[model samples]
Target: MTPSHPPISGASSRRLGFLLAAGAAVLFSAKAILAKFQFRYGLDALDVMALRMGLALPLFALLAVRESRRAAAPLQARDRALILVLGVLGYYLSSLLDFWGLQYVPVSLERLILFLNPTFVLLLGVVLFKRRVARREWVALAVSYAGVALVFVESLRLEGDHLALGGALVLGAALAYALYLALSGELIHRVGPLRLVAYAMLVSTAVTAIHYVIARDPAGLLRLSAPVYGLALVNAVLCTFAPVTMTMAAVARIGSGAAAQLSALGPVSLLFLRGWLLGESVSALQVLGTAVVLCGVLLLARPAANSVPLDPIDDPLPGQAGNPPGR
Candidate 1:
C-alpha cells in the first residue's frame, strides 16, 4: 500500500503568506519615497520611470528566459498580445500616473491613495466580472472610502494647491492597476504567476523605453546623479522585482484574499518611512484615518461564503505540475 502524507495546515500556510505579503508591502511602499527622492534632482516622471524600467529590463528578461525554458508549452501569439496589453496598462500607464502624482503629493498621501487599490479591485469584480459583493463588503467599501476622505481632507489642508490634481492622478493610477489585477486572473492561471509577471514586465520595459525615446533625449538618462542611479537600482531590484515575485509566491501559498489583507501594512509603513526619510509629519488625523482604512480592507478581505479552501497540493509554484490556479 502507498504511504499516506499529512495535509499542510491552513494556519501555517496563512502565517507564511502573511509574512511574505507584509515584506512585499513594505518594500513596495518604499517606491514612493525613492521616487520622491529622485524628483528632488529635477527629474520628470517619464525620466524616472524610464530609468527604473531600463534598469529592471534585463532582470525581467532573464526571468522570462528562465521561465520560458521551463514552460510546458510555448506561448501563443494571443498570449503574447494579452501580456503586452496588460503590461502596458498595469506597469507603464499606472506607474507613469503614480510617479507624476508623486511630484504633487507627499509620500504618505500617495501611499494612502494607492492603498485604495483593493477597493477598486472589488468594484471591478462586481461590475466587470459580475462577481457578487455581499452586504458586508458594501459596508467595508463605505468605511474604506470614509477613511480616504479623511486623509484627503487633511492633504487638502496641507497642500491645497496641488492636492486635487495629485489625488486624481494617483486615483487614476490605482484604477489602472486594479483593472490589471481584475483582468489578469485568467492569464495568471494559464501562464503561472511568476512567468506571467516576468513576461508582462518585459513588455512594459519595451513600452517604457519607447516612451523615453520619444519624450527625452538619450543623453538625458546619462546625466542623472550617481545617488539617483543607486536609488533606481534599489527600486528596480528590491522594490519592483522582489515584491512582484514575493507577492505572487505569497498568493500561491495562501490565497489572493489573504495576501491582500497583509498588504494593509503598506500605508502604515509608508507613513513611518516618510516621517523618517522625507521629514513628513504624521498627524493624529492621519493615524486615525490609517486605522480606519486598514480595518475596512481587513473586512473586505474576508473569504467569500461560497469560496473553496485552497489545498496545499493546489498551491504549487510556477513551473510545478500543479500550476493551474492564479495567485
Candidate 2:
C-alpha cells in the first residue's frame, strides 16, 4: 500500500493566510513614508513616480511574460486594450495623484484618506450595477464619512491650504482606484489575480515612462540623488511588488472579506510608521476618526444573512485554470 500524507487543516491554512495578509498590510503602509523620504531630496512627484515605475517595470514585465507562457488561452486584443485602460486609471493616475498629494500632506492623513476607498467602491456598485444598499450599509457609510470629515477638519486646521490641495488629490486617487476595483471583477475572473496585476502594472509602467519623457529629459532621471534612488528601489520592491503578490495570495487562501479585514491594519501601521520615521504627530481626534472609519468599514465587510460565502474569482487555487504553478 502507498503511504498517505495528512491533509492540511482549514484552520492552519487560514492562519497562514492571515500572516501573509498582515505582512502585506505592513509593507504597503510604508509606501507613504517612503515617498515622503524621497521628497525630502527635492524630487518632484513626476520624478519620484518615474523612478518607482522604472525600477518596478522589469519585475512586472517578467511576471507578465511568465504568466503569458503558462496561459492556455491567449488574451484577445479587446482584453489587452481593456487591461491597458484599467491600468492607466488604476495604477498610473491613482499613483501619480497620490504622489503629488504627498508633497503637501502628512503621511498619516494621506493614508487615512486613501483608506476611504471601500466607500467609493460601494457607491460605484450602487450607481453602475444598480445594487441595493441595506439600512446597515447606509449607517456604515455615514459613519465612514463622518470619520473622514473629522480627520479632514483636523488636517485643515494643522496644514492649512496645502492640506486642502493634498487631501483633494488623494481623494481623487482613491476614487480612481475604487473605479478600477469595481470594474476589474470581470477581468479578474477571466485572468488570475497575479497575471492581471502583472499585465496591468506593465501597462502602467509604459504610461509612466512616456509621461516622464514628456516632462523631463533622460538626463534628469540619471541625476536623482542616491538616497532618492535607494528609497525608490525599496518602494518598488517592498511596497509595490511584494505587498501586491502577498495580498493576492492571502485573498486566495482566506477569501477577500477576511483579507480586507486584515487590511485594516494598513492605516494603523501607517500611524506607527509616520510617528517613528517622520516624527509626525497624531491627535486624539485623528485616532478616534481612524477607529470609527475602521469600524464602519468592518461593518460593511460583513456578509448579509442568506448570502452565500463565495470567494472572489480573483482568488484561485494554485495551478487552477486561471492560476498557474510557481506563481
Candidate 3:
C-alpha cells in the first residue's frame, strides 16, 4: 500500500486564506466593541445602524453599477422575488436586530452568537436539503459552539440580562444569515455578488425605514456627538463595507459555508481584542474555556473529502452598530 502524501502547499494556501478570513473577523469584531463606546455619547442604536448603512450604500452602489455593466446576470421575476425576500431577511432585518441587540449585549457575547452561522447552516442544510454532515464536521460544529459558551459566560458576567438577550437576538440573526449563505450561491450565479449586496442593502434600507416609522426610532439622530460620529464611520465603512466586501471575496474564493465555518472563531478573537483594547482582563477560567473552544474550531477546519463551492451573500454582517434608516 502506498502512503498518502499531504498537499503541503495547498494546506499552506488554505492557512493563508483562513488568516485572511481571520482578518475579516478582526475588523468585524471591532464594530460592536467600539459601539459600546457610544454610551458616553448617548447615541441611539437605530440612529447608529441607519448611519452605518447609509454611508456604506453609496460605495456599494458605485461598485454594483459598474459590475452590472460588466457581468450582469439576469433572473426571472420569481427569482427576483426570492432574491428580494432573501435580501430583506438576510441583510435588512438581520442588521436591525443586531444593532438593537447590541445595546443589551457585550460585543464579545454578540460575536459568539453571530458566529453560530456554521451550526445554523449545518442544521438547515441537513433538515431542509437533506445534506449530509461529515462526522468530523459535526465535531467542529460542537467546538465552535463551545466557544460561544465561553464568550457567553464572560458576556453574561459583564452585561447580565442585556448580554443574554442580545446574544439571543444575534443568534436569531445568525440563523437567518446561515439560510442566506445556503441559498445565496445559486442566487449570485443568477446575479453577481456586487449587485446582490446593492439590492440587498437597498431592500434592507427600505425595510428598516418602515420599521423605524412604526417604532419611531432615531429620536437621537441629530444629537450625535463627535465620538458617536466616529463610531458610526467605523460601523459603516470599516465594519460594514470593508469586511463585507472582503468576506464576499472570500466566498467567491472558498464557499460561504466553509467561510462561515471558519468565521466561528471570530468571538474568540474578539475576546482578546476587547481585552487588549478595553483592558477587559478576562478571568483565568474564561481563558481556558476560550482555548478549549478554539480547539473545536480547529477540528472543524480539519480536512474533509469534499469541500462545497462558496456563494456567500454577506448582506448585513450579524454585528453590532448601525444607524437607523434616514437617521
Candidate 4:
C-alpha cells in the first residue's frame, strides 16, 4: 500500500483558511479600483465590462466543459431554464448595474453599498418567502442601514454630485443579486455548484456581448489603449477568476462562517485603497460607518438555532460569502 500522509493540524488548517479568505476579499474589492483606472483611460462602463467578460469567457468556458464531463447526468430542461433566468438576474444584471454605478460614485462608497447585500437578501426573504424575522435580525437590519446612511450622508456632504443616482444603482444591483441568491437554493441542489456557476457565467457572458454590440460600436473595442486591455485582463483573471476559486477553497477549508467573518476585510481594504490609488478622500465617519456595518452584518450572519448555514458553493460570484448573504 502507498504511504499515508500526515493529517494537517487544526491550527494549520485554520491559518491557511484565514489567508485564503482574506486574500479573496482583497482581490474582489480590487476590481472596483481596476475599473476606476480603466475609466481614466477613457472606457465607459459597458466597454470595460465587455472587455472583462470577453477575456474571462474562455476560462469560464473551459471550466464549464470540465464540469460537464464530470457530471453524472445532463442538465434537465427545468434546470436549464432556471440557470438561464439566474444567469440574467445574478451575474449579468447585477454586475452591469454595479459597473455603471461605479462610474458615478467613489470606489469606497461602491464597495460599502455592495457590502450591504446581506441586508437586501434578508429583506427579499421576508417579502418573497414570507420568512419570519427575529427581533435581533430586525435590529441588525436597522443598524446596517443606519451605518450605510452615515456614509452616504458623509459622501454627500463632501461631494454630492450624482451621489444619489449612484447609490440607487448600486442598491438595485445588490437587490438583484439578493433575489438571485434567494431563488438559486433549489437549483444549486439540482445541479452541482461548480457546474452551475460555470454554466451561469457562460450565459452572462453571452448577454454582455450582446449588450456591448447593441449599445456601442464593436469596432471601438479593437482600438482601446493597451492599459485598458491590460487592466481588463487583470480584472478578469485576478479579481474575477482567482478570488472565486480562492473563496471556494477557503470555505471548504474553514467552513463558510469563519470564511465569511474573515471577509469583513474587503470593505476595510477598499476604504484605504481608494484614498491611496484613486485619490478619494477618506473620513473618520466613514471608518466608523464601516465598523458599524461590519458589526451588523456579523450579527445577521450568526447561525440561527437548528437552521442550515449559508452555503458559499451556492454563490456564483467572487467573494461569495464575503458578505453574509453570499454576495
Each prediction's Cα lDDT score? 0.74, 0.74, 0.62, 0.77
Model 1, CA-based lDDT? 0.74
Per-prediction tally of clashes: 0, 0, 12, 0
Model 1 RMSD, rounded to 1 decimal: 6.0
Q: Pick the candidate with the highest lDDT.
A: 4
Error of 2 at 177 (Å): 0.6
List the candidate 2 regions with Cα displacement exceeding 4 Å.
1-10, 305-327
TM-score ranking from best candidate downward: 4, 2, 1, 3
Any idea how many clashes model 1 has? 0
Worst-scoring 10-residue span by lDDT in model 1? 318-327
- Report the C-alpha lDDT of model 4 over 97-174, residue by residue, as the tens digit: 898999888888888888877667667766876666677878887888888899999988886879899888888888
Task: TM-score for candidate 4, please give it.
Answer: 0.91
Question: In candidate 1, which residue ranges exceed 4 Å CA deviation?
Answer: 1-18, 252-255, 305-327
For residues 25-70, what per-residue lDDT tens digits would candidate 3 score against the true structure?
Answer: 6677677776777654665566666777666777777876776788
Better of 1 and 3 by TM-score: 1
- Residue 297, candidate 2: alpha-carbon lDDT: 72
Per-model TM-score versus the true fold: 0.87, 0.89, 0.78, 0.91
Question: Compared to the true structure, candidate 2 yields what TM-score?
Answer: 0.89
Relative to the true structure, candidate 2 has a C-alpha RMSD (angstroms) of 6.2
In the range 192-270, model 1's lDDT, one tens digit per residue, is 7778878878778889888888876878889878999998999888888888777766776766655666677778888
